[model samples]
Target: MATLLLIEDDLMVRATLRQILERAGHVVIEADHGGEGLSKLEQQHIDLMITDIIMPEKEGIETIIEARRRHPQLPIMAISGGGRTRNMDFLEVARQAGADSTMAKPLRAQQLVDEIDQLLRA
Candidate 1:
């Protein structure tokens, strides 16, 4: 099992994700925003990161870039419900910013775990 950093602004969504990850045997560390998530990353050993794209303090794109710069070997997964705006696709942006994988919100539990397993294996 991996120790994962789960960065999301929504309380309910974070809780749900925590439950899912914990049930799947991963230790979940939560952060309400990317800034906090980065802080946690600095203080601990995080095996993976699952971040929401449209967070408040620091958004996912910036977070992914900085995290990649700091921890080039760390695996990152970006997730969002609002994947696209008027002319931008945030998930695609996340990929360019250094996310190892991306998934839309309202994520399927099994698929989420499966993707995580693949990322961990890699």
Candidate 2:
């Protein structure tokens, strides 16, 4: 099983994702926001990262960029439910930044597992 990093600001979302990933047999490390996520990344050996965009402290796109610099081969999956204004497509921006994949929220747990499996295999 891969050690996956999950960075999301919403408590419910984070909990739900953790459950799903755990059920799929992944060892998930949680972070409430991008800054904390970055700290976790520095402290451990992460095989993959699943992050939400529009988060507090340090947005996901910025996290992806910085994490890429630190671990260039680390696979990242950027997820977003849009922003407050509903005008920003942050997922696209995340791709431009360095995310290996992007998914919209409310994520389908099976698809999420499949994607993670694919990333880990790659």
Candidate 3:
């Protein structure tokens, strides 16, 4: 079991992810955007983070960068469905920004759980 911070802009996605992580036996802290995620990072002792790329106020890449800077040891997982036009894959950018792992949206539940376990174990 681990404490995970999930930063996502879509309400439905956030709720779904929360359910998934919780079902996997992890405690999840939800954030509507990267700004809120950063604040939560300061307030909570998070074992891992799962963030979306596109968001209001602040983007996941920015969050990843700052989080890495402040908490270099903290593991981060970045997820994205791509840009609205489907031209850009922001997940790569997130990896460059310091995400420990990246997964595309419409993610498979088992893959997510596996990745979380891998990151936490590392």
Candidate 4:
């Protein structure tokens, strides 16, 4: 089972993802925003990180960059929804920020798990 750190500002999204991942047999650690997520990264033994793009305090792109600075080998999955994004170039932005992969929001359970499996294989 992979140790996953999930960072999402929306409570409903965070809870849903947590349930899905835990049911899939992974250990999940949740953070409410990028800042808290970053702090958790400093303290937790995370195998992979799944983060949302928009959040208070710190953004996912910034979080990814900061995390990559300290943990280059770490795998990151960046996710974003349609409405709240100020920028249109999410995939490109995340790639530039050093994320291993990006997933669009409102994802299927299997899709999320499968992506994590794929990234781990790499």
lDDT winner? 1
Instruction: Give the TM-score (vs. native) of candidate 4.
Output: 0.94
**Candidate 3 clashing pairs, residues 3+ apart or interchain:** none
Candidate 1's C-alpha runs over 4 A off are 83-88
Better of 1 and 2 by lDDT: 1
TM-score of every candidate: 0.95, 0.96, 0.97, 0.94
* Residue 116 lDDT in candidate 1: 98
- lDDT computed for candidate 2: 0.93
lDDT of each: 0.94, 0.93, 0.93, 0.88
Q: What is the lDDT of residue 20 in candidate 3?
A: 96
lDDT of 1 at 99: 98
Query: What is candidate 1's lDDT per residue for 21-55, written digit by digit as tens?
Result: 99999999999999999999999999999999998
Query: Which pairs clash (backbone N, Cα, C closer than 3 Å) in model 1?
Result: none
What are the runs in model 3 whose C-alpha is more than 4 Å off? none
Tell me the spans in candidate 4 whose CA falls farther than 4 Å from its real position.
85-88
Per-residue error (Å), model 2, residue 86: 3.6
Clashes of each: 0, 0, 0, 0
Residue 36 local lDDT, model 3: 98
Model 2 ranges with Cα > 4 A deviation: none
lDDT of 2 by residue, 1-122 (tens): 99999999999999999999999999999999999999999999999999999988998989999999999999999999897776448888999999999998878989999999998889
Clashes of 1: 0
Mind giving the per-residue lDDT tens digits that candidate 3 earns over 35-88?
999999999899999999999999888999999999999999999988586634
Give the C-alpha miss distance for residue 38 in model 2, angstroms.
0.6
